[model samples]
Structure formats: C-alpha cells, structure tokens
Target: MAADPASLTDRRLLSDDLLATVRGRAAIHDRENSFFADDLADLAGSGYLGAMVPSPLGGAGLTLREAVHEQSRLAGAAPATALAVNMHHVWVGAARYLHERGDDTLDWLLTEAAAGEVFGFGYSEAGNDLVLLGSRTEARPDGAGGFTFHGRKIFTSNSPGWTRLGVMGLDSTTDPDDPRIVHAFITRDAGGFEILDDWDTLGMRASQSCTTVLDGAHAPAERVMRRIAPGPSLDPYVLGIFTSFEVLLASVYTGIADRALALAVETVGRRTSMKSGTTYSQDPDIRRRIASAALAMDGVWLQIDQVAGEIDSEPDGRADRGAGWFRATAGLKVRATETARYVVDEAIRCSGGSTYFNRSELGRLYRDVLAGIFHPSDDESAHALVAQSLLGPVEA
Candidate 1:
C-alpha cells in the first residue's frame, strides 16, 4: 500500500526508532564509501524528506522546529548524507511557502512537491557571492504573455533529482517607466536546461552541487512564481521558510560536532599512548579539549532551541521588535556552523596523526563539517544583515 504523506509524518513523529532510521547504515556513508546513492530511497520512504508539504497537499504540515531536530539527528549520524538531505528539505519548505500564497504557479509547484518531487535552487550565480541583488540573469518577455530565461545558474544543490528549478532573476525587458522587476520563477523539466554534474569538491561530495545551464528556457506565464508587490510586504509562510532553512543548516553543523565529539571519545577510550601509561581519555590535555568542544556544542544547541521556540511564538514575519530574534537566528546559524568547524578541527587534533586515516569516522566528519562554514549563510554578509536590521539601515 502507498503511504500517505500525512500518515507517514505521524509515524515518523511517533516511532521510537526515529533516531535509528536517521543513524542507519552509518558505515556506508563513511569516508571510504564517500557517497550515499543507496540511502535516498530509504530516506524518501521514511517520510523524513517530505514533511514540509501542507495538509491540503497531502503533506505532514510539520513546523520548522521538527525539521531542526530531525536534521540535527541526521547530521550526527552521517554529516555528508545529512547535508544532502538538508538541501532537499530547504527547497521543500520553500516550495510549501510559495504554495500557500494562493497563487496558481505556487499551487502547481506545491502539488508536484507533495507527490514526493524535488526542486533545486539555482540562486548562486557564477562569480558572485551572497549579494544576489546584482544578479545578471535576464528574463525577457516572449510577447505571448510568457517569458524567456537566458542565463546560467551555478552551484545548484541536488542537481540530478530536481523535478523543478526555482530561479530568481531580473526582468530586464520590463518597461523602464515602471519599477525594475525582480521575479522568482519555477520551471519544470524544461528541455533546454542542463544539469552539469561537475561538482567534484573536497567535502560533501554526495551533495552533487552541480552547475545548471539554462539556454533560453521558456517560462510560460503560469510558471512565474511571483512578482514583487508594493504593499505592507512579507509573508508569514516565507518567515517560516527562512527560519526553517537557517535552523536546519545550523542543525547540520551541530550534528557534525556531536559526531566528532563521539568519535573523539571512542578513540580516546580504545587507544593508549607510550608517552602515558593510560588511554587518551585519561590524559588531562585530551580531556580538556573534549570538555571545551562539549561546552561549545551545548551552547550552540541552546541557541537553536531558544530560537525555534521564539519563531513558533511569533509566526508572523513582521515582528518589528523581533528584528532581534531574526538577527539572533541568523547569528546562531553562523556561529553554530563556525563552531562545528572548530570542533571538528579540535577533534582531529586530539585524535593526532591517526585522524587522517580514511578508516577513522572523524576524518570524514572533518571534511563534511568544514563545508558548512563556506555556505552563504555562514559568512560576514549574513551577519551584516542582522547587524543592519538591529542597528537601523546604514547609509551607502
């Protein structure tokens, strides 16, 4: 029998084996394996991947708080696999957000997504940073109430599994007399589009963050996700979407640190050094390192929990006084991600030369956790946004 998305969500929530499912077959996702082609089906079937879809669309209607806990658990099990799953959930939540806005385009995307379909984000342009306001992709009218997308989208996450691509570009052909249109479009399986699976990187190799080239992809009128409207602005669902993305991303880092700490503890328990008559665990230096990492990881978890609670309380995006909450969430994302990198590095140091061995799980975690800090949300730009919002708009 086919499992209903909503029913599956309930099962996942209530099951005592939820942690076991996330931490499944960890050895296969370790360093020597280096990929997780075998795990996606299990993940999809487990209802771990499609929880964001709404009830009307046959989804679980679970909130961002649920996603954070699940993502963090997955990260602790296998950071690489968790990172891939994180990308999928990010798009799923965003799709649900757009779908709830009562627009036809969003409605179609939401329906498809609810059927266990995947959408990839193509926001990172080539030779560009997080500042997408200066995006070069051009959308020109095709004169039949449709538009043509002619540009390249680089660093598209989960390229192979994408049933639809969410694109953001400027409508250059809009009448100059009117305001410049920054439009978000959703195109499904366009033939002209190509996913360049050339994402061979040092870390998170399983992510498949490939480059997608759009060679005049025809976006029909129904495909446009939404146009920026002049009004009070901000959608409650969009707030949920952003918060979900940030918290989940942070969870991945926290999980990485958790796993690394575990491996460090295990290694210390088993290995003994000639310099000392006892195991590494007995060494005060190693114990101190472990203690520091533990403290940092705990601090990060506290921030994530607090932020989730605050976001739930203030469902609306318009928390004028809640700018601090928003900024704090962003800062937490950056801090947790950065702290994970440090934790992994310290764990490696504590593990010594043996940490470099591919057999060591800590070695794999080190590579995976480092990638989190390089994501757009981990950098100064994200922090600056928080500061600007809390400190008032800065003069250019």
Candidate 2:
C-alpha cells in the first residue's frame, strides 16, 4: 500500500504542521510589513537552511529537482517567505553544482552555510538591466588581493538575516583595457554596508527585501569569487549561477499558481449561481475556466523538473548538459511567472468579490504575482533569447 500522505509529510522538512505555522504567519507579516522572523527561525531549526549541504555533512543533500519541489511547497504556504529564502538556496545550490564537478572554489561557502551562516542575494540594481552581464557598482582593488565595492543594490532579499551577502561590481581599475565583473561576498560584520528601510511595496512586504547601500564594502582576498569579462559567455560559474537561480525562481512562482488553482477549486465547490440554482462546480463556464487554469499549472512542473534534473545531472555545465540552456531557463522563468499571473486572475474571478478585499488570500496572491514580471529574464528578454536560439541574434 502507498504510505499515508500524512506520514510522508511528517518525514519531510516542510512538514504539514510547519507549513500551517508558516501559512498562519504569512498574512501577519504581510499586514505588518515585517520580516518573517518566526518562519525563518522555524525553517532554520528544521535544517532547511542547510538542506543543500552534502549528506555526509549532516544536510538533507537534496538534488536540484528535490529542492525545487520543496521550494514549491514552501511557496504554496508563503510566497514572499519562499521567494526571499530562495536566495539562500540559490547560493547553496550553486556551490553544490560546482562542487559536484570538481570546482572547490565555493567549498568554503558550503561549509560556512552548513555551520549556520545564511546568505543573501545582493546583485540586483536599479538600472543595470544587463543582469549578470555587467554591473554599475564599482569594484576597486584593495591592493592586498582584495576588493572594495561602492554602489547601491535593490531587492536585497534576506537582508535581515544574511550573514553573507553575494555582490558583484565592475573592476575597472584592474585593467584599463578591459573591465571585469567581479563577484564576491561581504560579511554582515564587515562594515561599510547598510540596509535601508525602504522595502515597502505593492506586495511581498513580508520579505523585507530592502535596498542595500554599499559604501566601500570590502571583500577580502579570499572572498573575491569570480572576475569575468563584461559580457555574456557560457562560463561554468556563470552557467551554474543562472541554472540555480532560474530553476529555483521558477519553482516559487509555479507554487503560487498551484495555490491559486487550489483556492479556485475550493471556491467553485462552495459557490452557487443565482440563475442556475446550483454550485459553480456544476456550471460549465466555471468548470471550463477552472480547467484552463489547472491545465496551465499542470504543464509547468514537468518542464521545471526536467530542467532541474538536467542541471543536477550535468553540473559540469548547463550548456554542455543541453543545447539552448539560456533559452530553456529564460523560457521557463517567463512561462512560470506569466502562468502564475494568469491563474491568480482566474482564481479571483471564480472566488467572488470578497477576494478583492485586502484581507483575502487571493488578493495578496494577485499583488504578489505581479512582482514576477520584473524578475530576471523579463517577458521581452525571454522572448528575445528564445528567438535568438532558433533564428539567431538580430543582425547588427
């Protein structure tokens, strides 16, 4: 016999009770516009923060695919919380991706994370649309084989709890002829960086992804991780970061769509139409809309799972793992985020006007889903990458 779902859930890091606790706290955090401190504490206590550490190191040692599934579950319980926590997972996953393929550059990161240090993604900037290809932040050599960063970063997730912040800047002084994009980590106690209290936004307030201001923030010689040319290349480190980020990011939004669909199904089951004198579940139009939403959601996981598996299997490199990796990752990110927006809209339409209230779960999801459009590989970029993959880049 198949094991009872409840028993299985009990064995997981995101156990049912844990999710309930997190779910119960999501609204409060959103309402107060505060960080999910309790949720983070609980997750850390459950060993979730160290889930990417190797099994021999006392971590769960989940594969990329397994971690994606767990992220979806966490997101279904709390989207903002899950989205913020995803930054930590992304770094750990990248380290694991590299380590499995004989790259020990980030082994210290893995070791530090397992020892209870949390990391945050601090790469986003206000106007650096180049995404990882370039940076507006300045990286000046400290002359001791180290570097000092000077600039501002937006959407600095896990700002409240990160012991280490991953950052990148352009090291123009290193070589006048060629400025390299330098990636490094700055510790919270290192000084020179401040978290601005400016995260208030349309939604996802619980994340407290405030703006981080770096004024001569220092990354010690050993802390400087990578220095690549100021444009796109299929470098292994670049591919590892892209794969981990895109797949995990997609999983979070997919979970939002999943939750919205479930809520819609529950709504239809109880809603009755005045003209039909029957539940919305019996209404063909309602059923059809709900089906469309479910179908869209159902289509996302397989692609996400497949891509994640490919990344896990061939961390030697995503590009080498398969052709059109940029296309695959960019396409999946756009697909999942857009699907989430579509499904949340449908769920609201079926759930009645009460869902329009701020107090409604669907309302929160609607606002949260909108944030998806702005993540890396936006709609236009994703389409461009997909087009370039098939038809080649637009002529100069």
Clashes of each: 0, 0
Q: Please provide, for model 2 over 176-272, each residue's C-alpha lDDT reduced to its tens digit, 9 standing for 90 to 100.
A: 8988999999999988998999989998889889999999999999999999998877876777788889899999998888888888899889988
Best by TM-score: 2
Q: Give the TM-score of candidate 1.
A: 0.84
User: Cα deviation of 346 in candidate 1 (Å)?
Assistant: 1.7
In order, the Cα lDDT scores of the candidates are: 0.66, 0.86
- Highest lDDT: give the candidate number: 2
**Candidate 2, poorest ten consecutive residues by summed lDDT:** 1-10
